[model samples]
Target: MLESVLKTIYVIWYRELIRFFREKSQWAGMIMQPTLYLTFVGTGIASAMTFRQAPGGTPVDYMTFIYPGIIGMSVLFTSMFSGISIIWDREFGFLKEILVAPVPRWAISVGKALGIGTIVSFQGTILLILSPFAGLSLTLWTALKVLPICALVGFAIGLLGISIAGRMESMQGFQLISNFLTMPMFFLSGAMFPLHSAPQWLQVLMVIDPLTYGVDALRNAIYAGIPEAQAILQHSIAYDLSIVGLFSIVTAATGVTAFNRQG
Candidate 1:
């Protein structure tokens, strides 16, 4: 079982790496988006805002507070866009080749999801690398630990994306599904602000948003010890991870099931 899992992981991971490196512009975008958002969006928002007191009397300057949001948004979109690639694979017959592999169908589904997760985690590394510049008080140890959690969350999102992509019979149809999933999840996820401060409608919308759980989990990780966001995340970590875990299991089950279905 262990060897099978390892082999499955390696095959998908290698294919993902090849795909990522094959396009220079894609890699550049992955590294660029977070940097620009931190330098501009995060800082610009912090500069004009006067934060009220919260847990631990944490002072949220725009950049520091927005850093985690940027990371969260980056991971969310990166993993979700991975579905577009899966669509591309289908168009090019690559997905059929994968489907015909000798491995169990679940292995293939997990492999692809894990591959997407790896890429999304790479994006997180790029974002967090700019942490100090955005006045984020991050440590190497914390950042290292953040990697696995980010990857896991990304994996879960990838599985969800895979299931959605599987039902899309055409590239045009897949585009609509991608837009539908990505935009709503991003906007309603409290990525721009916390749920308590949001309007009642947005708060209710967040009740069904997986991205909210992911953002909360990530915030808890980096801010676990920091004075500002730490209190907010520390209070919320348990609940966030629980939700994230649930998302992972549910999406993975659905994705693997879809992979096993007859075409």
Candidate 2:
């Protein structure tokens, strides 16, 4: 039974990969948005704003601080919309065909989420190669450590997309709802600023936003590589990972629950 379930997951995951690569436009948008955000927005802000000294008394620029957050933003947008594929599958009659198979509903949901998560994670990893331009120095060991974190964050956000997509039948409706949700989540997650000094009301919202922890985890991991920045960064690796892990589990269960109710 376990073997069959695993096989189902692999097949679903593989299908997602094949579809994503076949669509050249998807690659363009995914890579373009993050690059523009990091280059244009990041550069503009870094020039206009003077940041406080980092933990070890080293002066840090706004661009350097916000780089990880932007990476989080990239993952957030891509993974959160992974459910659009589900809507597409449903509309094309592929999903209905899969549903009649002997595989469990939870497995299908998990598989779709994992597949999208895997692809988005790889995309984020490729983006990481540009970190040096943001003043982040990545050693072989650090790169190895960051891989799993990126994948987990991807999976967590993919579950969110699946949960939302499961209830949505129309692509247009999904796009509208996803855009509304994505903007606020990105802004509240502190992707463009530090949450430590945010307004109380904003801080409260950030605490409740699951993506906040994911961004914080990315920030924590990036800062871990910088000795000078270590003191100023507030979140510990363990704390950030714990929050993100819990969020993943909750979203995974939510996706499963929602998919189970599907006809």
Task: Name the candidate that leads on TM-score.
Answer: 2
Q: Native-vs-model 1 lDDT? A: 0.78
Worst 10 residues of 1 by lDDT: 226-235
Give stretches of model 2 more than 4 Å off. 53-58
* Reference-based lDDT, each prediction: 0.78, 0.82
Per-prediction TM-score: 0.89, 0.94
Candidate 2, clashing residue pairs? Answer: none
lDDT of 1 at 182: 80
* lDDT tens readout by residue for model 2, 149-209: 7778888888888888889979998889889988999999878887766889998998888
The clash count of every prediction, one per candidate, is 1, 0
